[model samples]
Target: MPTLKLAIADDHELFRKGFISMLSNVPDFEFVLEAANGQELLDKMPGHQPDIVLMDLQMPVMDGMQATEVLFEQYPTIKVIVVSMYDEDRFIIHMLEKGVHGYLLKDTTPDEVEKAIRRVADEGFYYSDFVSRVMHRKMVNRLPANKHPFFPNATNVGLSNREQEVLQLLCDGLSTSEISDKLFISSRTVEGHRLRILEKTGTKNTAAAVAYAYKNHLI
Candidate 1:
């Protein structure tokens, strides 16, 4: 079986090592890079090409929030799952805003960590039940912001029926191939719809696209 390259960014050495050790025996999992902080993570990522990253928020050199924004702009292909101790509503809401594929508490189970890795790897997102419930409540209570001319017309965005279908499936966390199988369409066709949805909604990645769908009540 092909290996899945993984990386972790954390300031705590003991925790970093322990986290890696916990998953050391998982099949097909390989650690290609490790970083003490977010800046270090960015510095090491270019040559390593990890498929996914387990990020921590409170790093010394550069925090996860900054790194996440940079990663979103720089490495759109690399998925990130924030594994932090903080579960404050603001922290959770902001991470989702920054486009992480998943979020997990640092105290979560190794099984959950492994499962989250596999889920994000296969589905492009894995918002566990906890995160889902928190996000839904927060989004519901969010106050309406001033409308700005710079924002894409998310509410007014028009999508073909097929594109709408694809967006809904994406919001459901179905990856390209999964959507292909479910919809009986080619992967390339699914990708095409994915791109058009991003363009129409002004989102850069699937995570952001799903966020857009939620923020705009699209799905």
Candidate 2:
């Protein structure tokens, strides 16, 4: 298998070294570059062009949010996973809005980190169990009436209840395969539901559909 190229950006030297060491044993991950801060990350990224970036939220010369915005603007294909000490809802929401593929706490184990990287690289979103729970609860509490819970302006015109459930699972960041396993259905069935959901909502992608749902208080 081809290795996944990764770049790590953090202000602290010790933590950067520790992270590099921890990832050294993961077979498919290759550390392609390291940066002391977000500015350095931005400066080095054009040349290195790693597939994934492990970013710290707080760093000198430029913070992770700024760097992430810049990176996404310039390199939309590169995936970013924020590994930070902060777990505030504001920070989480902000990073998500800024297009971070994953948000992880700093205390995550090395194995968890490896898993998260792999998941985000494959599925486009990665959340720990705790983060998942938090997001779910938040979604439940914020669910809006008169809108399909997964699509705000979506009329729910021709969708069945099962399709709505699948959309919710998608908005909750479950991959189609995961949704199939969770619902005890086939992956192809889940994929069909996804296509229908996209059509009904008039959204091109999952992220935009989710954002529309959230913005209009649909979920």
Residues 1-219, candidate 1, lDDT per residue (tens digit)? Answer: 788899999999999999888887987999998999999999998889899999999999899999988987888789999999998877886787677888899889888899989988876778776777676666566544344344334356888889989988776666788899999999999989988998998776676677766666565
Instruction: Please give each candidate's TM-score.
Output: 0.82, 0.80
Model 2: runs farther than 4 Å from truth? 140-163, 171-173, 181-219
lDDT scores of the candidates, listed in order: 0.83, 0.78
Each candidate structure's count of clashing pairs: 0, 0
Q: Highest lDDT among the candidates is held by which one?
A: 1
Give the Cα error of residue 56 in candidate 2, in Å.
0.6
The alpha-carbon lDDT assigned to residue 142 of candidate 1 equals: 50
Give the winner by TM-score.
Answer: 1
lDDT of 2 at 79: 89
Task: Tell me the TM-score of model 2.
Answer: 0.80
lDDT of 1 at 50: 90
